[model samples]
Target: MSGDARGLWVTFEGGDGSGKTTQAELLRAWCEDEGHRVVRTREPGGTDVGQTIRELVLHHRGDIGPRAEALLFAADRSHHVAALVAPALARGEVVIQDRYLDSSVAYQGAARSLGAEEVRELSLWATGGALPDVTVLLDLDPVAARARLDADDKPFDRLEAEKSDFHARVRDAYLALADADPERFLVLDATASAEDLAARIRERVAPLL
Candidate 1:
């Protein structure tokens, strides 16, 4: 995706409570320290339209059908890339995003049994095949991840409140994605120290910068 673009796009992916937000913030700060302009954002809530979709897809009280959920996420992704990510890259600003197509592939696709390749293709079409220069996958055990969330004492969102098996499927799907595209993915152990993970992420991203 960065082949013709002047800027780099880096996306973070993982299950809920995998410390994706924390690592994304660390990378954002490091990029600023290195004198790079950074555009930090997240999927489903990256824009006004996305924020509404995020609420519907993630926090709504009732159930959303699998295909409907996938389409909602795709809608958010389409607008997010067009209105935010693409513009930032055009201006030569590093875009650090939390989650992306990978989340949709893992959650709505694998966990929801909607088929990974199908979900991926939908996202690709939605974003006009836009992809990140680098993707960081923070792999973590679902049990451990759940423990982290429980410790936080926050109410679980719709996806986060799913059964353990569902989350396990999401993790497996993520690992498969990393394995399939090792070049674009930096798979890190979410169990590692935050500082250690940050350093490893920087090492992977420095060359791209």
Candidate 2:
């Protein structure tokens, strides 16, 4: 690990059932094995306050206005960065996160028909412009992702329950984000074997450590 005062921040982004959690855990274990302190967390529920917001946004029975949903996610990001992420990095601990502003931009901005730039700006403002050192994007077809979700036999969350078209738009938005920031993004095929994906992610993150 580098003896630098600041630590690395790594985030994973993808649609439902894209295997982001699996990759994140693999990276976490790898970092720990390298003798680096690691902090594994996720947006919308990384902190105690964020847990309440996560439930309301992800599991609420009724509909939530698109703008309201964006705001709620931003609020969670604000608190999560302040109370958890930033502090972890300051302590020189690697932060492995499940999602970040990219999800808000993809889900609430482009997919919901709101302006992508607008939602991105709101998230940047909320987090005081925090960004991950590396972002691994598991690109997968919406239909395939849906099939995987269905196989789990678990109830879908509000976002996961969205129509196919919605998920397609989210996928496009994520790709666009990656295109705009190629340096920070490692876009990989979600259909690849878990070990292969983990190896690629490790390759990208090893230089930072």
- TM-score per candidate: 0.99, 0.97
RMSD (Å) of each candidate, 1 decimal: 0.6, 2.1
Please provide, for model 1 over 61-91, each residue's C-alpha lDDT reduced to its tens digit, 9 standing for 90 to 100. Answer: 9979999999999999999999999999999
After TM-score superposition, the amount by which residue 162's alpha carbon in candidate 2 deviates from its true location, in angstroms, is 0.3
What TM-score would candidate 1 get against the native?
Answer: 0.99
lDDT of 2 by residue, 1-209 (tens): 12333999999999999999999999999999999999999988999999999999999999899999999999999999989988899998999999999999999999998899999999999987888899999999999999999999999999999999999999999999999999999999999999999999999999987
Name the runs in model 2 displaced over 4 angstroms: 1-5
Model 2 scores a C-alpha lDDT of 0.94
